[model samples]
Target: MNHHDPLLEQLNQLISEGRNPDTLHIDTASTLDIVTAINTEDHKVAPAVAACLPDIARAVDYIADALQNGGRLIYTGAGTSGRLGILDAVECRPTFSVPDTLVVGVIAGGKTAIEHAVEGAEDDHGQGALDLADIRLSAHDVVVGLSASGRTPYVTGALAYARQTGCKTIGVACSPNTPVLQAADVAICPLVGPEALTGSTRMKSGTAQKLVLNMLSTATMIKQGKTYQNLMVDVNATNHKLKARARRIVMQATDCDEATATDALQQADQQAKLAILLVLTGLDVESARTLLSQQNGYLRHALKAHC
Candidate 1:
């Protein structure tokens, strides 16, 4: 089969596909020279992400609203972008003590696609809509589409279906002026320029996408009162390390000794935020729980009310 499609050629015209003049001679350069060239390109990723802060902030607000209303935040993409979405979704549960259903990741080819490439999966627009449908996406949800090229048919289809279903949509893309952006209610385009090795977007573009996902999840959780003064107050102490961290969080929040913090955590039924409230406000476990509940788990707000 002849693989020379005009659309592919047009896609190659995208900035992500443009070859970097700086790395043209990398093949003949020393190892240090190649590293330096790639490092120079990598330096552009942060500022590119910084340029899209407004869009990212908008996304965070949208996600926080959806989550607060009992709706899930869904991320859809293909390839490296898909993996990044899943990475962010999986981390949210342990990091913020949220349920897995609250944040979801839908890759183009399903769970099997996480480890192996599913041929032509990204090209299947209908499957994209089907994937979201399978999740029972609703009007209260927010769907974020991740596409390095900004034209993945899978993501574009998801965004369209999400809009049709009255779900809010956000698009994160590395290239400027693409379909994913047009399909989304809010577009976050981090123009990281071309890859050091031509069309390899998994490097710089992947880094930018990861950064945006970090901001989206972290900021949304912060808005939801998951953190208490920069500490992971809602952290799930499901493991030894996390339990230690939870204890430390209580200690840090109330300036209490380790023994007192540990005792408070135990008295509060191993709940970090409640323990902190108990220690800081000198309230019983039930009163601390009530105050935290009244403030929607915002430690600072609960502290202000009792202190």
Candidate 2:
């Protein structure tokens, strides 16, 4: 098999099938005409994702089940895929108050790769195994592999390793007939079709992956009682900005005045989840703390018991 041959052919097909934004006849025609064409193309993305909502939902439910049992969520990818994984994990803390250890992202070339591409890092299957080992993957974890081509060696290896260890694994790819999908327990193939830039999955494919990951992580957090009636009840007030948000969240959830919210937050020692619980149940800090400890740190559960 000629290593260069596949790449050359793929490149040629890419150029042939790619949409030439330059060829678009978007001149000084009425602004309406220009807007129409752009809108038409953008509209295609949602329908593409809509067609696969069932599959995406299935993957999310699977992940939620694992996480309920103390499982972690891990993402594996290379380059743009890796960056997206990291992005999702990082956002969990601020968005849902998840601990950093709950969501792990394994990039192909490690931390250095996030900034600069590491040559041939994607091809290293052994490295993928090593990274998973370092993270101490267990059967209670879920591994998600992201690859546009559905064939990145590193991601495939990580998914394979995770499955072997009795952990649930998911593969998300833009293209059809990807090997990574076949290896994973749940395969999410968002048929965004070919990219406008041909093989550049970072275009439509990347957007689809981002949407799916958002749904997965957000839905999981909600399922775990991190939210209280659509409000973020588990916010971490680690900084001044977050402390302000914590007070606001408490106020919103309990319909308390700003002073009362501030008092609750202070009583809970700046722990937003506990503060919300205390305000909602009208419990003192010690009672709220005991209720939360009994309810697995879920503010909603603690509130239900106390109130």
Stretches of candidate 1 exceeding 4 Å from the true structure: 1-4
lDDT score at residue 277, model 1, on the 0-100 scale = 89
| lDDT winner | 1
For each candidate, the alpha-carbon lDDT, in order, equals 0.93, 0.81
Model 1 C-alpha lDDT per residue in residues 63-90, reported as the tens digit of each score: 9999889899999999999999999999
For each candidate in turn, the TM-score is 0.97, 0.87
Displacement of residue 253 (Cα, Å) in model 1 is: 1.1
| Top TM-score model | 1
Tell how far residue 143 is off in model 2, in angstroms. Answer: 0.5
- Candidate 2 regions with alpha-carbon error over 4 angstroms: 1-4, 7-40
lDDT of 2 at 48: 73
| Total backbone clashes of candidate 1, pairs 3 or more residues apart or in separate chains | 0
